[model samples]
Target: MRYLVRDRMLAFHEEAWVETEHRQRLFKVNRKLLRLRTTFDFVDTEGRQMASIVKKALTFHHTILIKQDGENVGRISKRKFRIFGDRYKVTLRGGRRLRIAGNLWDREFDIADDSGTLAHISRRWFTIRDAYAIDVMSEPDWLLLVILAVCVDHIIEDREGEQLTNL
Candidate 1:
């Protein structure tokens, strides 16, 4: 399966959606702001809650917990001391772990398991809007992968906004 993840350009907070190649909406991602904690809500096309990504504060590296139906499903944490580029350690449901590495600035990256590649994400596929493509390679955990993609996007956006403020 493949999906297109796009951010709302004019929105005040982080809001995005996942769409099919033909532009059919698949999931809606909503980020909660002005709250005690950071949380991202992922809802299906039919408006049912799918998962919640909650940020865990006060960590040496960025860490987030992926929850579904109030149960912890996964964890996403940044890899530290990378001199070359950014990398992430993703712990999916059932304790399956994967490493994500590539050029986050260009929005081109891949997730790989011990066996092989699982998903490829790139922005070069589209130039019209702030969107990226996720190509899932026969992966049954596509939903978790998409949510992780959005989580990475949120981290990048927050970092960019911080840079702008410091300028």
Candidate 2:
């Protein structure tokens, strides 16, 4: 399964769409504004909340929690200290671990575990600028794959913002 993720910068708040390859909208990535913690809600086409990617506050390393039905289904956290490219860890509630590795800053990477690659996030499609598609290989975890891609994007943006300073 492949899904297109497009940023809607023109909106009053941060917003985006998770759509099908043919451009059929599947989910709306709505950023919640004026909140203590950074958050984004993934809503289905029928206006139902599918899941939420919430930035965990007061943490040393960047961490985003994926919640479904108010339960922590999975988590994406930046791994501390790496000699080469940046690395992230995805932990599922089931105690399974997946690692995100590759040119994450460029949005080209792979989400995989000990078993194998779960999904591939890339810009090879290049339909829209800053837009990327997640080619999900595992059928059962498609939602997790889609939401994981967005969580990676959010973490990257957050790190970039933290690097700036007023001098």
Candidate 3:
């Protein structure tokens, strides 16, 4: 599957079966790095986990872009770790079953299915504080761009009352 998160994009594929296995690969790009950790878990509607299959961590590096309202923001270097198999037969606690196939790019991620359709993308930004405990510059300027992109895409997709959830 394929999806665009901000200026970043990712794609994945899975086999048709009750369960599948995925191999994790690592890469690096300049000063940026990615450590992707994949896992399988049964979760409830509240996102609580029921069971988890832990895997190894895949470390890599890549270039990432962060933009807000089509404007460029700051950038970040990141690494990814895959904690489980790339392929999984996820059985949600709600009785919904699906194959989880996706990857993480720094603070952004794209998850998709067999048809190369995006299920979701996530972006995050953090605030940094100093010795005086004063709020300093916000971390990950690109996160704002990612959030804006997701919001715009959500509006275009018109999922109806779908609210953005902070990670």
Candidate 4:
């Protein structure tokens, strides 16, 4: 007799970007983490302006308040948080979590279930290409490539913005 264990896992790649007259912000999703803490510099394509944002968003708080439609939902306190490198973890109120690892201007992310089946939540103009070998599971490789793309896109966008502003 064979016993099968059904482990439900979902994963997907995503990218986010915002364009403005003066600047553009982008982010890419990478691996998920239980806990993350780090700092990185933000530079344009020319590698100028070495400023950074110090972030410390974790998942150990007693209760995380999620507001929807200006209404407060029930408190959430038992979710896991994962941060690999400069990536950020996005958690929804409904036990669903999205691990994002790119920049605010251009990013790539994956939404998955606990068991690891990849899913496509949404896609935008930004691209999510798969490259590299990141983990034994063959998922991290693609995630890294996505992150790189996001960073490059942000740098280019920033450069363009700066040139326009100077004119």
**Could you give candidate 3's per-residue lDDT for residues 58-96 as a string of tens digits?**
324212233323433322222233366233233323343
The model with the greatest lDDT is 2
- Name the regions of candidate 3 deviating beyond 4 angstroms: 1-49, 56-105, 125-167
Candidate 4 lDDT score at position 61: 36
Model 4: per-residue Cα lDDT over 1-167, one tens digit each: 11111111344422222222133332222322343532223333453422332224454532333333344322223223334343434344455554433332333333233665242212243233322111213344333222323333333344468779999
Q: Which candidate has the highest TM-score of all?
A: 2
The predicted structure with the larger TM-score, 1 or 3, is 1
Residues 99-166 of candidate 2: C-alpha lDDT, one tens digit per residue: 99889777799999999999999987796776899999998999999999999988887777777643
| Cα lDDT listed for each candidate | 0.85, 0.89, 0.27, 0.32
Model 3 CA lDDT for position 21: 13
lDDT of 3 at 165: 36
Q: Which ten-residue region of model 1 has the weakest summed lDDT?
A: 76-85
- Candidate 2 is scored at a TM of 0.93
What is the lDDT for 36 in model 2?
86
User: What is candidate 2's CA lDDT for residue 39?
Assistant: 92
lDDT of the structure predicted as candidate 3: 0.27
Candidate 2 Cα outliers beyond 4 Å, as residue runs: none
Put down candidate 1 lDDT per residue, 7-114, tens digits, no spaces: 888899988889998899988889999887789999998899999999876677888899999999989898545687899999877778988888898878898889
Give per-residue lDDT, candidate 2, residue 55.
Answer: 91
